[model samples]
Target: MATADTMLQTALREPARRLTLDLRAVTFFDSAAIHAVVRVAERFPGTLAVLPSRQVRRVLEISGLASQDWFDPS
Candidate 1:
């Protein structure tokens, strides 16, 4: 999970005013990814959004990270 951790670290350090995760082409959304999204939201607060792919939507939804409470899809 080194790659996942690195990706998460990179995202956490982003200086954007808003953070949008476009997972529309992602085939795999694991716990690490889920944690990353949560971390981003915690860091950016209302500036977090997500566009998850159909392939990984179920995983994200089931994980309780694909919701307006977690992020707004924009």
Candidate 2:
């Protein structure tokens, strides 16, 4: 959670820069991590796509957030 928060903080520090979360190597995607991603996306006002691994895609589907525009289930 802290790491995700730090990601958000970094994004906040550079609002003009685009942010992309590369979760292609992440084998675990918990609710807390999802929440952190959500919080970060909420603050950013544009398309915030995340490159998700299969494991992350499963979690996102289970969380019912798979359909969200920010997540790429590739």
lDDT of 1 by residue, 14-70 (tens): 788877777678777778777776777788788766777875678876866666564
Clashes of each: 0, 0
User: lDDT by residue for model 2 over 1-74, one digit each (tens)?
Assistant: 54666665676676554578888988876767888788767866475878889988888888888888887776
* Best model per lDDT: 2
Computed on alpha carbons, the lDDT of every model, listed in order, comes to 0.71, 0.76
Q: Model 2, 27: alpha-carbon shift in Å?
A: 1.3
Taking all chains together, each candidate's TM-score versus the true structure is 0.78, 0.78
